[model samples]
Target chain A: MSVAGLYNYWIVILLMMTGFYVVISSGNLVKKIIGLNLFQASVFILYISMGKVADGGAPILREGITHYSNPLPHVLILTAIVVGVATTALGLALVVRIREAYGSVEEDDIHRQDESL
Target chain B: MIGTQLPALQVVVPLLAAPLCLALHRPFATWALTLTASALSMLVSILLLGQVLAQGVIDYAFGGWAAPFGIAYRVDLANAYVLLIVTTISTVVTIFARRSVASEVEAHNQGLFYTAWLLCLTGLLGITITGDAFNLFVFLEISSLSSYVLIAMGTERKALTAAYQYLIMGTIGATFILIGIGLLYMLTGTLNMLDMAHRLITVADSRTARTGFAFLTVGLGLKIALFPLHLWLPNAYAHAPSAVSAFLAATATKVAVYVLLRFVFSVFGVDFALGTMPLALGLAVLGTIAVLSASTVAIFQHNLKRMLAYSSVAQVGYLALGVSLATPAGLTATLLHLFNHALMKGTLFLALGCIAWRLGSVRLGDLKGLGYRMPWTMGVFVLGGLSLIGLPLTAGFISKWYLVLAALERGWWPVILVIIAGSLLAVIYIWRVIETAYLSKTNKTAGAGEAPLSMLLPAWLLAIANLYFGMHTGLSAGIATQAAAALFGIQP
Candidate 1:
């Protein structure tokens, strides 16, 4: 947990916060979905980083391979990736529908239209 | 044969049915399939609950793998009770959805609605049954994704926006949960909930575990619509199709509460979750704020569904308050309310759906003289409202009474006062509905009539359940106490 060794987590945290901020602050629905994706990608990285064992080989058993990195997180992350993709697709489709409904995907415009209703 | 596979079938029946529903592409057939799956799930849940009651905790490990190495379905009193509540609500709502969906969704789209319905059902039951942390996340996403679709299927355009909003929020909540699980997995090298609980004890004092716990609480707080994080709930519930609203309001947040309870008591142990982290005080304060603020907000809402949506937030506060008290009695109150609130809210929302089906809207203005036109539907609404107000001989009173008793046991007089004040606010809001429906005058009511028996029957069924459970505490309270004991890690 030295300063140099901890930099990876720091970067992951930075990316996660940035993604969260964008999702919260952005007015456009598409940008929000991208922000969500970025946030999820950072989590994937964090999980993968935790699974890494120093000098460890891939989890597959092979001749002369004594140390193996954890494989479970990778499998879990694969499932998570599928979920994230599904969410993004759903979000994008909603954005398309929102455009059809409100004639815009921007939050401000949608709000104004809703108010006038 | 079915006894052994009940845990797996509880989820698989609905999971498999979703695609079958989609493939069938016939509205009537899909509805029939959804109804059958829901009924089957409900039956299995009841059987599982009976097994748990008779034989103690039932643990079914998948594919013959044991414990931490493979996923497990662990059913004790707590989860068995949750499973029953969720499947029962689904069964009832699906029965109620026949006319609701036909009226709200286009004929071509009804199959998709049933598909999403079964997926959501599958996801909810899976979350309740699974003992693995990662498996819970998978199920959470499954339910969430399908719900977003279901919400967007509303007749109103704003349903899209509400679905989008919930998508962002739900994904954030799920991601935070994933992070927490990842950190816990890193520390313990196990994704199994029980193993993590065992391992977490040793690392309880670690900064990493503390961070993970924080992530978990906030994530689940959002999912449970706890107080300040409840922004997505009102809109999502209000704008969704009436069947979706009734189903989600009744089961979704309740399941989230179950997860929070599992994490707090069973997984983290109450000592760590409540004692160490300032979580108890935070939850209590937030719950108080929600009860007061949301109820006050509810009183002002013109839309009946929106009003009930806000009231739901307030009811969640009562559950939070019980959890914050961190006593067996307090947890019992929370569990009892979990069941009672589902009955009350399900009935209320379904009645509103019936109103909407007849009148095309549930705005307070439109509801004028509804009591005269649709006496049965309005009568159901009145019963639900009474229960919501914690009237004597209604299920709501039992939960609030238990909460008050728990507060008294702890000598928390102010909390007792807060609970009473919250109920008063509920009375005010419920009165608004009654006043608009029964007292206000309206014109052009000749075409109006009772909601079809299809809708009214299911609505009255739950309405009567509200009264039945109100008088008969043997089932709800008895199971609640046993579940609470099990949650506290006692074998009783």
Candidate 2:
């Protein structure tokens, strides 16, 4: 395969590394969650891209359609999407609790407060 | 009629009860529902193990869909062993949770707390029982999200931050695993683990397959809290309420270890993972480091709960060391320690729950002269502590004895030395509690007395189990050896 054939994978890697960098570098709690979302989104894209077939129509079989993209990855990603949403909601709920308990969502502030205790 | 449905029911019992628990407003009602679910699951797990030993691996296809197309639940000896461990610990901790949760958690929130705990149990058992790779990831997230909720419900404010940090770390780990599974699905075009393993053979030498393995290893290494990726463990264990601590500490990581072994030896095949990849030496080196560093760190902690948390990490190191050996004997040792560590840590954490119930603190300073005030409670603590240190005639020593035997067979002299050093470190940390409780002046008791019979009975159940299993190794060690041989695809 030519380098041009791997375009989606390059984008996947780029988005993944960028999101991972934000998650690791950002001290703000909400920002880290956003980065985690981005990281997961890249994986969704990777999965979706892998399921495509050249010149394929929708997975729904029709008269005269000789090819179709795999639908299993789509189905799998839907479940992953649901799990990702649940994780985000739970994470944000914890962030709300953190803000209430430590009076700030900044990592440094929470650490100092816990240390003082 | 229900005999054949054991695999699905092992998880569904807890999954269905979680929502019912959330609906029940009374704390006691929710606790009863959760206990009922775990007890049923434990019974099913025992039957499943017996069935597995009798019939070999049992495959249950969902919705009547066969494997390679529909999701399946396969109960081999290994799955039954892990399922039994998770269900057993969950059942014991559910029994231990009534008073612990009432005192530690707010009354209004107890229903929701038990709901999350039930979901966590569903997830851990589901992960161990499923034969589908994608299904395992879903269950992993289920357990992790519920654990975050459970951890955030701790008594101290720091629990909030601990849950938040774990959420971040755990989510990243889960996503990495999702990517790995997706890659495997792309190459094999099937999600069934056995089918994937069969398909993976011809493609196993590919770079993509190798990348998938690396990703899976790192993700699971995070889940296992292996040495480098272990920062999230101590705080998560230390800050959670004691019942949650006991249950999660006992089951979650052990389940993760089972998954790791399954993916490595079963899915990837031992040749691709350990033989081709140099994984044996890498895991051995990291396991050694984790044992040395985590054990040394445990001795310096002032909080007894946090100290035990670090010890949990070191115990995980022993499991990894056993896996690194890549022999049937080594795996048997790992399996034995998996159960033994759960016994010791479960007892220790439950005992700490009792201490926190009475004294309202678990710091080293609060333990001063506590032996005289709560003799039975402190006696349980001392026995748990001795087991943690792997003293003779205890469950902990039985596993360590096997671990040393394995190392000696492998001619890993340095690992043997590390094991000795790790045990010495455990003695120092455990003896600190004993010395503080018995030898100190009697000014720091806080006027507390023995915990309720309800709590003491459950702690002693596990403590006595530790001694019983230690003396009669036939059941624990015998089954572990059989399961280990099966995993290695050899005759016991």
Candidate 3:
């Protein structure tokens, strides 16, 4: 398999679609957060893949090497990863608060209880 | 001195205020600091707007780094207008929150509330000002995380659940947006928006660019609650505390709409977004559906806050409708409605906050006869409601007028008909509240007196401004027209 083949992007897209499916289909709120994390992780992978240079080692500035990986995409992915982590943490916190208040993590059950009220 | 630092100060003032609020710890002291910080940021935003108007555009590279290499803060006519709206709303809402927060949020949590409010303000302003695409994502998370915390601080037990729902949906939206940014960077090898715009023009017809554009549009569409993707909004708005409701209603979605505009016109260019794809027609259909369906749903909502939430969805439809027109007049209409809706809805939500403070519930049954007791508060609500319905002398009317004109300009009379029909539906929902408050003789609201002066002042100020701006459309309309024309690279 050649390194420049499109397999890496295919895997990333698969992971992203799976994560999206879980987020949309799952009834459990915690599961949805997990799915969101996976979805973001897939995006990070995509960014890292785009930054890859064929036959090039690392992105460090070397004296002899004529080509190096794109550093801009790496930096952007790092910031995006931080944002993803922040969103995950906030989502979990909200989930804990929701469980405390509603006494359930299932979306359907919470809606049922709210409707009853 | 301040003129040079205006761009940085617009964000730093609120960012620094969060820590000061935490250090103070006392509720009153935190409130005072937050208000002062918001007012200061508003002052800086005003100065920045003035500079942008006079000097064409202001670009400040962070840490003195040049553009396309380091992050830059770009202030053009479009973003300066948004900055003014965000900062001005924050200033008003912060003052209102001082009184409104005491009754809704717990005492110990008040400090944290102010901190989160400040952070949210900073994030919103930062998102509007930043020129780097990745920086926009970072600031978006700052705002989203803080907004989740603020929404959870509501007194109602359901607020936590609402916040959780918002968190999940917001995370999905953010992830989509990050992916879009990643894709764009993959193709262009840069994160700067202007640089990306320049690069995108060269490869405008590539499959990767088209896919990237689709992701960005859908992601922002979800954030701005464009029609079917707006499920998270009504619940979040309905269960959150009054102050949170007012702030988010007025600013958050407006900022998201601005982001959509930035990408559609500035980043991707109008030719690709509005011409290459059927996006304009699709958006026009969705906007019309959202207007009719959301308004119909709002008419049946028993809770005043929930009704207003659905109404907000309908108002978003109007903005989307303007964008769908894909003409300079259409963009101007969208920008105008963005400002007008912020003022009208902010006032409406603030008036509801006053009612919630006194009556402890915003359900229509509980609000019967409220007009008799809290005459001033109810008067503000009525005025806001009239504006929501697009009465001739309110801010809403001006936006609708321009939207219809844009539609008619393109010979799309069906869109004009939909606009009229949507406003009629709006009249129905607004009438529901009016009838419940005035004509009904229920005894539930017998003791509901007027709200405190602190609350009424902010609410009435926005309400009066609605009428004032509606009658005199010089400032907002002029700025919006110029901004919209600039967006299309045309002179007005």
Is model 2 an incorrect, acceptable, medium or high docking prediction? high
- Candidate 2, B392-424: lDDT as tens digits: 899999999999999899899988899999999
Candidate 1 residue lDDT tens string, B282-330: 9999999999999999999999999999999999999999998999999
Cα lDDT tens digits for candidate 3, B235-348: 899999899999999999999999999999999999999999778987898999899899899989998899999989988988998999899999999999999999999999
Residue range A1-117, candidate 3, lDDT tens digits: 564588888889899999989999999998998998888888888988888888876877788888888777787778887777878888888788778878999999999998897
Model-by-model lDDT, in order?
Answer: 0.94, 0.92, 0.90
True contacts kept of 1: 1.00
True contacts kept of each: 1.00, 1.00, 0.97
With a 3 Å backbone cut-off (N, CA, C), the pairs that clash in candidate 3 are none
- Off by more than 4 A, model 2: B444-446
Of 2 and 3, the candidate ranking higher by DockQ: 2
User: Which candidate tops lDDT?
Assistant: 1
Give the better candidate number (1 or 3) by TM-score: 1
Q: Which pairs of residues collide in candidate 1?
A: none
